[model samples]
Each structure stands twice: as structure tokens, then as C-alpha cells.
Target: MRFRRLRAIALKELLQIWRDPRSLMIALLMPFTQMFLLGYGVTLDLKHIPVCTFDREASQNSQSLLKHFEASSYFAIARNVRTYPELISAIDRSDCKIAIVVPPDFSERLNDTGTSSVQAILDATDDNTANIAYGYAVAIVSGYSNDVALDALGRQGGELQQIQPVAVQSRVWFNEDLDSRNFIIPGLVAVIMALVGAQLTSLTISREWERGTMELLVSTPVTPSEVMVGKLAPYLALGWIDASFCLIIATLWFGVPFRGTLFTLFATTTLFLTVVLGIGYLLSVLIRSQIGASQVALLLTMLPTTLLSGYVFPIDQMPTIIQDITYLVYSRYYVTIIKAIFLKGAGIAALAVPILFLLVYAAAVMTLAARAFRKRLD
Candidate 1:
């Protein structure tokens, strides 16, 4: 008999969700759309770059270097300046991201001592862009030096002692190829689960309250736990379907690797959904109106989950207090687990901490939601 009522309620919720095309569209498209926008938008690739040159020397070597900068695909010489003041003024006016100063003794020093230094001033307004520009400038200068010294090296190569420099090799561990899709799809899965589980469940339950169904529900023989589970079961299924779609799309279309056990991933994701759905249920009980519950759920879940969960922004770089706060957010552990399982092939032992956190989050949120429901019904 209880199974019949549970099925009826779940069926009604699914029907309502099906009728709402907006919610259906969001469930389908939001994750992929975010992946496309944020992945392409946050790239490290450099294209046409604005640069200014202050060549006071105007010598053959300086002219040769300037020609190389002009010819390179990475840089466009936006302005030529004879004085430091003009270069500073151009940078201040946002004419160029980088300024190169060639000293008066550039060619003379190179001819006499075989070594010369150039000054590159980078605008620090956008640190990442500035860092890339700085590397490009350094590469251009190093190429110039290499080209000029090739002839000298060729002449003295026979029986000459060579200078060896210390070299550092860097390797990325989890993402060997640095495929942004691997990181992004997992993060999007976390964000999408948060939105669906929290926003939808909260709004649906709040709608029930506004429609005076909660009074009828509490007056029935159904237990609070059963009612709460019944209310969340449909959304939980929806969240699972959304997650499956994301995992398949990312793996098949984008070629994102899934290295860990699929069962482990699903288990962790289920815990995450429970925490998010519980929060939604708690929000619904606290706020009597659908709009208020929806707003509160969105505010509590969406922004922080996306921003502070190390989805796009690395948590290591965030403020310490904010990092401390992320511990309480279910999505934080979800992002960690998904990224680890997908990218790092991390097993249960490797993911124990995040798994524990997710379980604890689910338990806490579920307890709170049950209490909220009891209070509201009484």
C-alpha cells in the first residue's frame, strides 16, 4: 500500500517536470553550455598580442630583433617609442600589454662582449595574460640570441669545451595531456547536480506547501521520513539521469577519460545528490513560498559551488577562510571526487577523505531537513 502511494507521488513529480520544458532544457543544456563557454573562454593560448618597443639604440642588432618581433605571429608591435616616457604613456593608455626597452649600447655591447640585456615591462593588470606575454617576450629575445650565436658556435665547435646548464622538467600528473574537458566536465557535473537537486526539490516542495498539500500530507498516516524520501526520490532520479548524460557526453563526444571504477563514481555522486537534495528540502520547509525557496536554494548552492569548490578556481589560491568554509559544501567533495576519479583514476583508498566528507554532509543535511519538515508540519 505504501509502495503504491510512493509510486503515485513520484509519477506526479515526473509528469510535472516533463511539462516544464524550461526545466528540462536546463537539465540538458546547462552543463554543456557552461563547459563550452568556460573552457574556451579561460584558455591559455596566446594570439595577436600588443607590444611596444623603445629602441633608443636603433642599431643593426636592435633593428634585427625588432624585425623578428614584428614578424612573429604571437606579437604585433603596436607602437614605436624613442623615449621611456612615450613607452610608459602608451602602456598607461592601454595601447600595449608589454613594453620592450633596448638600451643605447645594445649592438656595441653585443659586438664587444657577446652579451646584452633587454628590459621588458609587462602590465600587471591581468596577471595571467601578463605572465604569458612575458614568456613570449623572453622567447623572442632568446631566439634572437640563439640565431646570432649560431655562426659563432659553428666556427668554434671542434674540440671546444661545451657549457652545460641545469635543466628542469615539469610534468602534469592527473591530466597528462592537459585536456580542459576532463577537468571541466567533471566540475560541470558537480554544478549541474547542485542546481537540479537543490533548486528543483526546494521549488517543488515549496509549491506543495503553497498549495496546502503539506497539511493534507501531515494529516495522513505517512511517516515524516517516508514523506521526505518520497518528496526527494523523483529529483534524485532526475539528478542521476542528468549525471549519466554528462558522463556519457563528456566521454564519447569530448573523449574525456574515465579511469576510476564507474561504480565508485556513482556511489560518491549518489551521496552528493542526497546532500544537495536534503539542503533543498530544508530550504523548502524554511521558506513557505516557491519563489523564496528557489531563490534561497540557488543562492546557497549555485554560486559558491561553482566558485569556491575549485571547479574553475583552484582552492589552494583562495583565501584561507573561504577554503575553510568550502569544507561544509557538499559540492566541494563532489568536485574533488569526480575530478579525482575521472582524471586521476583515484580509487576508494585515495578518495577516502572526500568520501567521508560527502557522507557526513549528507547525514547532516538529511537530519536538518527531517527536523525542518517536522517543525513545519506540526
Candidate 2:
């Protein structure tokens, strides 16, 4: 009998949600759109860095070295300069990110002393890109040097077996291709859900107050607990649908791997939705103004979820106080769970701490929201 009442309230809420086209659009389409924008728009991979060369040698060996740089997909030779000043000008003008300076005695010294040196100058304004480009340049030069050394030893009647070195083989686990999208798309699940879940419920009760319908509902036979459950039900279903869309897009469109079972994914998403929805409900009950509730919800959910939740940045690298404050951000646990499931194939046993934290967070926020609702009624 009591279940029938809850069902009626839930149905009414669903009807109301349907009546508002904007709300319906938000619930049905916003998450997928947001994920698409963020997933494809942002990237960290560096490629095709422009390079300038100052080749004083004009020799066969110097030209050979330049050919190696030109052959690599990582670098594009933008200009060949005659002077050091011209090389500096190319980098300063943003025409190139890397500059290679080959000395005049390059081939002569290499043939005579079995050694040669070249200088690589890099633009350090963007440190991460600079570092990666430097590494690529170093690797290319090192490989060329090794080949030259091997050829020189062969001409000296040395055997290939006496080249003298260890060959190392490396195997990357989990994400072998090392695609940044693999790491990024999974964390986006938590971020998108945090925004969608909170934004949906943030306006619910507050909109009732704005439209003068709350007093009517309060005067009816429907209990505050029933109203709360009804308000949460439709949005919870929407949240699950949004989460499923995110998972599908992450896997099919973005090519992110999902190594965990659907059961674990659904369970973690439910716990996360509960916490975010409770926060929105509590805000709605306390603020009673739809505009204020929406603003507060945006502030609470979106910024922290993207920034502090380790979705884009590592929380461990943050200062001690900031790291401590991140414990309060519920999306942190969800991001951890989502990434682990998508990347590591972590089970419930491996993710017990985050799961426990989400449980506690859901319980605490929902209890607070219930208390706030009752107080508002009084």
C-alpha cells in the first residue's frame, strides 16, 4: 500500500519532468553532449614539433643526420638557417620548437676521432611539450650514433657480435598503446555524472517553491519522505541512463577499454549519484530559490569535480591542505573507482576504500537532506 503511494508520487514527478522540455533535454542529452565535447576536445599528446637547423658542416654526415630528423614523424624541419642568430629568431618567432646546430667539423671529427657532437635547442615555455620533444630528439640522435658506430666498427674489420651491449625489451601493461584518451575518458564519467546529477535535482524542490506548489504539496497527504523519494526517483533513473550513455560513448566512440563488469559499474555509479543528488536536494531545501540553488549546485559540483577530484590533475601533487580538503569531494572516490574499473579491471575487493567512502558519503548527505527537508516544512 505504501509502495503504491511512492509509485504515484514518482509518476507525478516523471510527468512534471516531461512537461518541462528543457529539463527533459538536460536529463536525456546533456551528459552525452558534454562528454563528447570534453573527450575529443582536450588532449596531451605531442606530435610534429617544428624544427629549425643551423648546419655549418655542409658535409655528408651532417646532411645524413638532418635526414634522420626529417624522416621522423615527431619533427618537421621548418627552416635551414645559416647563422646562430637566425636559428634563435626562428624559435623566438614560434616558427619552430626545436633547433639543431651541426658543427663544421662534424663529419671530419667523427671519421677521425670516432666521435662527433651536435647541439639541440628547445623552447622551454611549455615545459611538458619541450621535455617530450627533447626526449624524441635525443632518441633519434642516439640511434643514429649507434648505427654510425656499428658501421665504423664493421669497416675496421670488427664482427657484429662484438658491438658490446645489452638489448632491453619493454612491455607496457594495461594500456599498451599509451593513448591519453584511455586515461581521460574514464575519469570523464565521474565529472559528467557529477554535473548532470546535481544540476537535475538542484532545481527540483526550489522550482516548486518558485511556482507556489510546495505549500500545496506540504498540505497534502504526501509525507516529506515520500516527496523526497519521489523527487529522487526520476532523476536517479535519468542519472543511470546518462551513465550508460557515457560508458557506451567512452568505449565505442572514444575506444576506451572497459575491463570491469557491468554490475560493478552500475553499483559505483548508483552510489555516486546518491551522494550528488543528495547534495543537490539539500541545497534546494535550504536555499528555496531556484536561481540560487542552481548557482550553488554548479559551484559545488562542476568545479570541484573537474579540478579537485583528480579527474584532470593528480591530487597527490597538491599541497597538504588542498589534498586534505579533497577528501570532502565525493567525485574523488567515484573518479578513482571509474578509472580503476576502466583501466585496471579492479574488482570490489581492490576498490573497497573508495566504495566505502561513497557509501558513507551517500548516507551522510541523504540523512542531512532529509533533516533539511523536514526543517523547511516546519
Candidate 3:
């Protein structure tokens, strides 16, 4: 039977893959290891941000305000300085991320004028962290001020019973907790897939050439299409298995929500693997050298997936030329699709453009890889 021959070739390739310990590691262990390291290591949540304070007044009110900053889980008061110069030294030495300067008249001014001012100096070397810390400080200060106002009003004939102003309530959609991991883990799937799929196949056909097995394979009854399919089958199955492991780790271990259907996830992953594997096969056939194929695969697949796929950075903020170039990166489309499925619970209709692009890319690359493979055999 035709199926029997194809199965035999697939099993042979699988055996070859199994005999190579490094390939087994890459196929089985690499994805989960990368996911674990990246998931736990990469984070945007700012916590325990060190701060130094200079309380010139050293009054009850100023102390009360300082206590709030120290109480917050977001901030930690590293040291209390006596002078502005000491505060500056802490920031300059990277001992603190923020510096609080409570004016000498802080308590007196608040008691007399019902208001007081405090200055916060931030180290902006890490601008994103600085901005987030600043926001946290503002929110704490605002809540303390509101408490002070309420206390004052309560003492004054219970003015709190009078008409209250409108209050604004904020609601966050999708990632309701605003967890950075929720956004990051989904995009990482694309990057890991690119690295694993491309690197694995990048050496496959090249290894055949290097081992001088191409001549033997060429003389077989297997057609080029059959050969390509048989070669791709085991790796494709491995890719899916790796993807499943990633999904499990992301959702259960990392606690990232999976909002889309399993069918959609599997479908998109299949299309993406097709694109990357085709690219790897094409490079392997053309170069006929494992080292060259690997370098080219890393350059084309891994680098682009990491940088241009909008995985770690925002594509919109990039230059127009760079953004235009990203359109050609298949990982870009897959990243969008994965993120939407993970975060937005997007259905097929919602992600038609990206799906279409992935389809076109897979078709084009597979066709080209087939041609290159046949020519190389001849």
C-alpha cells in the first residue's frame, strides 16, 4: 500500500531523529525550558521599588504620609536621609528609584491652609519603571489627601452628609488584572515555535547531504512530494506536541488565560509550522551545509520573530519603514493571531486577515521548498 511506504519512511526519519540526542532534546525539552525561563524571568510588574525620603518637618502628618509609602507593596523605603544631598546620593548610586522630600512646613501648612505639598524625585534611567513608580506614588498620595479632607470635613459639622461629587469607576477588559504575563506568554508561543521549528528542520536535509544519503534517497521509488511529506510528518507531529506542552505550561503553570477554542489554536499553529518548516527545508536544500543552514535559519526566523513580530515591543511605535518590513515576517501574523486567541477570545472571523496571510505564506513557501528540493535531487 502507498500508505505503508510513506509510514515506513516517516518511521525511518523518526528513528533517525531519535538516534540524535541533541535533536531529541531540541524537540522535547527546549520549548518547555524556554517557556519556563522566559515566563518566570520576563515581567513588567513593578514591585518593591526602593525609595529614599527626606522629612524636614519630621512631624506627625509627614510621618503619616511616609508610613503610607512604606506600607505599599509597590515601594520600599530604603533609607531616611537628613539632607537633599544625601537623597541625591542614594538615587545616583542606584540605591533608590524614587526620593521623597517632605517640606519643613508640611504639617503646619496642612493645618493652616488645609493643604500641603511634597516633592518626589525619580531616577529616570529606567524610564518605564520610573513612570510606573510615579503613578503608584501619586495614587497613594491622592488617597491620603482624600482621607485628610474627609477627616477635616467630619470635624466641621459633619459636612460629609452634604452632596457628594461624582466618582469615576474604571473597568479593565480582557486582562482584567492588567497582568503583564497575560500579554507576554501568548506572544512567546510564536517566538518559541519559530526557534524550534526552523532550527530542527534547518539541519534535516542538510544532514542528508552531509552524510551522502541524498544519492540513495534519490534512487528510491519515493517521489519528491512523498519524500518531503514523510520528512515533515514526524517533525510536524513533534511541533504540535511541543506546542501543546507550551500551552499547558502557559495556562496552568504561568496562569495565563486561554480564551480561544482548541480547534483555532491547533489550526493556527499548524499553518505557522508549515511556514517555518518550509523555510527551513528550503534553506537546507539550497545551502546543503548544516552550519550555513542553521545560521541562515536563525537569522531569518528567530531574530525576526523576536524583534519584528511585535512580541516584546510595540510595532506601532516602530518607524514606518520597519513596520512595513514586518508585514513580510510570517511570525508577525501568527503573533497577532495567537495574542488575539489568548487575550481577546477572537474567533475565526475576527482574525481573517492574519489567517489569510498565514495561509498564503505557507502555500508559497511549501511550493518553493518543493521545487528547490526536487532541483537539488536532480
Candidate 4:
């Protein structure tokens, strides 16, 4: 009897899900599109800066300094301006993001004294671009000075003065290359999983109630627990497909590293999906209409997972109270797990805490949902 009821409920849920083309497209295509768009768009790697130079002196030293900028890949001398007005106009018109002004005494000052300074005006409107430009300017000037010092030492044939020197070492733990794709792809998995799990499961269960088929099912020997499990089985399969698609595109198309065991990734994802589906089922029980259930599911899943999940933003940077609240959000732990697994090559031991927290969340939420659903039926 239980087996028959389970089969009937699972078939009904699958049919309803297949009937909706809009929801299906959202589940399948949105993840791939979002990952690719954000991966390419929001990258921090800087390249190809347009700059204008106003050289008043036009001396050998000034020309040599300009040559330094040309040699570096970061800057391309887009325009040569006669006066400060031209440079300012170019910058304001978005023709140049940085401008270098070489004063009239540039060569004289450098020849008379070992130290000389030039004005480097960077457009600070775009913070990331400005920071990259500043670094590029410092690097070019430092390289020029080092070469000059080396040449001067060779001419005099004297001991070189050794200034303060310290070695700085840096190691990027998860992503050594700091590739943005690796970070964004894994985070997309979390968001997509949450969206699909919540929306599909809620709509599936609620539609039956709205159409009065739930009353028919309840009149049979089937218990609410059996009906709930049956409704979830097919959606669980669909969730797995969503997860598999994300993993394939992230690894094959995007060239993201899959450092951890596939088994570990899939197992954790199964647990995560189960929790989301259970929550959706619980929402279906609370709301009487299909529209109300769908709205609640979308709102509850999208905002919390995207904002509080620590996927795009760092949870540590959030206020202390919000950080404490993150304990209840399964995505927060799952994001850490995915990033660690894909980028850091973390093993089960490293992911134990997150796994444990997910298990607790799944169990607690499912139990509550089952109770809530049972009460609604009675």
C-alpha cells in the first residue's frame, strides 16, 4: 500500500514539473549564464590602461622616462597633450584614465640631484582601476631607478649603498593563481541548487493542494509522511542533475580545478538539496494557494542564500550578530565546503564541521516540516 502511494505521488510531481517550461528554463540555464557573465565581468586582473602624457621639458631624461611607460604592458600612451587642459579634458571625456605630467626642469633636476619627482594623476572614480594604475606607475619608476643606479655604480666603480631590504612572501591557499572563475563557479553551484530545490519542490506540493487532489490522496490509506517522501524523490533526482550540470560546465568549459573527490562533492550536495526540498515542502504545507507557496519559497530561498550565504560577500566581514545568524543558513557552510574542496583540495576531515552542521540542519528542518505538514492535514 505504501509503495503504491509513494509511486503515485512521485509520478504526479514529475508530471507537474515537466508541464512548466518557464521554471525549467530558470533551473537549467540561469546557473550557466550567471557564472560565465560574472566570471568574465567582475575579474580583478588589470590590463591595457589608456594614458595621456604632457612632457614640458622634452629632454633625454623625460623621453627616457616616457619610454619606460611604453615598455610596460600596463600602460599605452594613448595621447600626447601640449597643455594640462588637454590632459584634463581627455580624462574627463574618458579618453584616458591616467595622466603623467613631466615638468620643464625634469632633466635638469635629475642630472643635478640623484632624486627627482614627477606628478602622477590617476582617475580615482573607479577604485580598482585606479589601484592597478598606481601599482603600475610605481613599478615602472622603480625599474628605471634601479637601472640608473646600476649604470652609475659601473661608471664610478665604487661600493653600492645597500638600502633597507626585506623579502615579502605570499601564498594564496585555495587558489594559488587567484583565478576568479574557480571562486565564482563554486559559488554559483550553491545559489542554483538553492533556487531549484526550493522553487520546484514548493510549487509541486502546493499545486496538488490548490487543485484539490491532495484531499483525494489524504482520503486513501497513504500517510502524509509517505506522500511527502514520494513528492521529494523525483525533485531530488532533478536537483542532482542541476548539480551535475554545474560541475561539468565549471570544470570542462571554464577550466576550473576539481581538486576534491567527486564522491565528496556529490554526497554533500545530496544532503544540501534534501534540506532545501524539505523546507519547500514545509512552506507548501503552510500556504494554501500555489501562488502564495511559490512566492514564499522564492523569497525565502533567494535572498537569504544570496546575501547571507557568504558566496559573494565574506561572512567574517558582516556584523557579529549576522555572523551568528549565519549558523542557521546551510548555504553559508556549503559555500565554505565547495570553495575549500574545489580550490584548496580539502578532504572529508577538513570539511567535517560543515558536513556536521548541514546534517543537523537537514534533520531539524525535515522533522519540523513533517510535523507542520501533518498538522495541516489534520
How big is the positional error of residue 146 in model 3, measured in Å on the Cα after superposition?
Answer: 1.8
Name model 1 segments beyond 4 Å from true: 44-48, 54-93, 143-151, 159-162, 176-185, 248-258, 375-378
Clashes of 4: 0
What lDDT tens digits, residue by residue, belong to model 3 across residues 1-378? 277668877898899999999989988998788898888888888889999999999988999999999899999999999988888888999999999899999988899998889999999999999999999999999989988888888898765775368978899999998888998899999988889898888988999899999888877777766777778888899999989999999999999999999899999999999999888888988899999998999999999998999987889999999999999999999999999999999988999999999999999998898877772455
Q: Each candidate's lDDT (Cα)? A: 0.82, 0.89, 0.90, 0.82
Which candidate's lDDT is highest?
3
Ten contiguous residues minimizing lDDT sum, candidate 2 = 369-378
lDDT of 1 by residue, 272-325 (tens): 999988988889888979889989999999988888888878888988999898
- Report model 3's TM-score to 2 decimal places: 0.94
lDDT by residue (tens digit), candidate 4, 152-186: 77667777666446856777876767666678778
Q: Which residue pairs in candidate 1 collide?
A: none
**Looking at model 4, which ten-residue stretch has the lowest summed lDDT?**
369-378
TM-score of each: 0.84, 0.93, 0.94, 0.87
**Which residue pairs in candidate 2 have backbone atoms (N, alpha carbon, C) closer than 3 angstroms, thus clashing?**
none
Candidate 3: which pairs clash? none
Ranking by TM-score: 3, 2, 4, 1
